[model samples]
Target: MEESDALRAARAVRRSVLGDAYVDGQSADPDPAGREFQDYITSTAWGVWARGGALASRDRSLLVLAMTAALGRMEEFRVHAGSALRAGVTDEEIDELLFQIAAYCGVPAGVAARRVVRAVRAERGEA
Candidate 1:
């Protein structure tokens, strides 16, 4: 892909994964190593991730939430999981995703997700 394509892909990941909390619009660093890693994340990973594949945006977001939850990164989950809902992912879908994570992301992660999901839902009157 082109450099512009790389940049666009990275931004999409940032917007969808990071929501409004990310303010680092520029590249990570000027060093070659940082550029290489960014390339890998933008071109190789995110690029190859959806190439010729067709999942709805909500599905993709759900997958991301599950993975992040598995890592026990509660802060990240609280945001992106809300983003996933905003992207049209349903509470049921998120619940299922969290269930899957519990099998892999552990009970604590799923439990934490439940609390967050509940709070966000309440904020939207979905509680």
Candidate 2:
């Protein structure tokens, strides 16, 4: 696809990933600390993720969700878990990722991630 078309596709997929919270997260009133740094991270992440190389989108997104969940950041993992699905990661893959992380991130963290995965799947009408 053309770059514009690719970007449009990415944006649509991004929107599905973020769900109803997209409006709240995007074009928002800036964060008090600074939105620029967040923008930088966002840009870097997107470029790395959408590069058409590196990791496959589904795997990249799944890794992100797993890493975030391992950190025990429920909300962020919740966001990324949904994003992973939109990136074409399957529910089975997500479940396995969380389960594998249990060995290192702990059972509690894995359980928490599973909860978010379930909720996300339900929201997407896939559960």
Candidate 3:
């Protein structure tokens, strides 16, 4: 199937925030179902990212981190933590966000998010 303009814009936004390597890794190879899921996320979630609303990309990155952490989606939290750094979210801001997560989402969720953020920072040599 041909890629739609929305998909193209979504991909550009996703790549800009997440980096080409990560986005390409996600696109590598997949069964039909997986491909469809990928396309859905690219066109939906990333499409919103492409829209450039009042929130800047950095703001959106932080929001994703917080939401994923609150939901206990540690893998996704890890992924977004790296992207958040790339998008200009400072480590201090992330640390503060973790505190907010602890207050609202519970201590365990905050601890899990901190672990993911630490791992992400270590991978980037920022720790």
Residues 72-127 of candidate 3: C-alpha lDDT, one tens digit per residue: 89988888888886788988999999999999999999999988888888887876
TM-score for all models, in order of appearance: 0.63, 0.71, 0.92
- Candidate 2 residue spans exceeding 4 A from truth: 1-24, 30-38
Candidates' C-alpha lDDT? 0.69, 0.69, 0.87
Specify the highest-lDDT model's number: 3
What is every candidate's alpha-carbon RMSD to the true fold?
4.1, 4.9, 1.4
Instruction: Put down candidate 2 lDDT per residue, 15-106, tens digits, no spaces.
Output: 55555476346636466445554344444555456556666778778778878887888998887876775678877887778778887889
| Model 1 CA lDDT for position 72 | 78
Give the range of the ten consecutive residues with the poorest summed lDDT in model 3. Answer: 28-37
Name the runs in model 3 displaced over 4 angstroms. Answer: none
Tell me the number of clashing residue pairs for each predicted model.
0, 0, 0
* Stretches of model 1 off by over 4 angstroms after superposition: 1-3, 12-52
lDDT of 1 by residue, 12-49 (tens): 76555445454254345678887667566666545543
lDDT of 3 at 20: 90
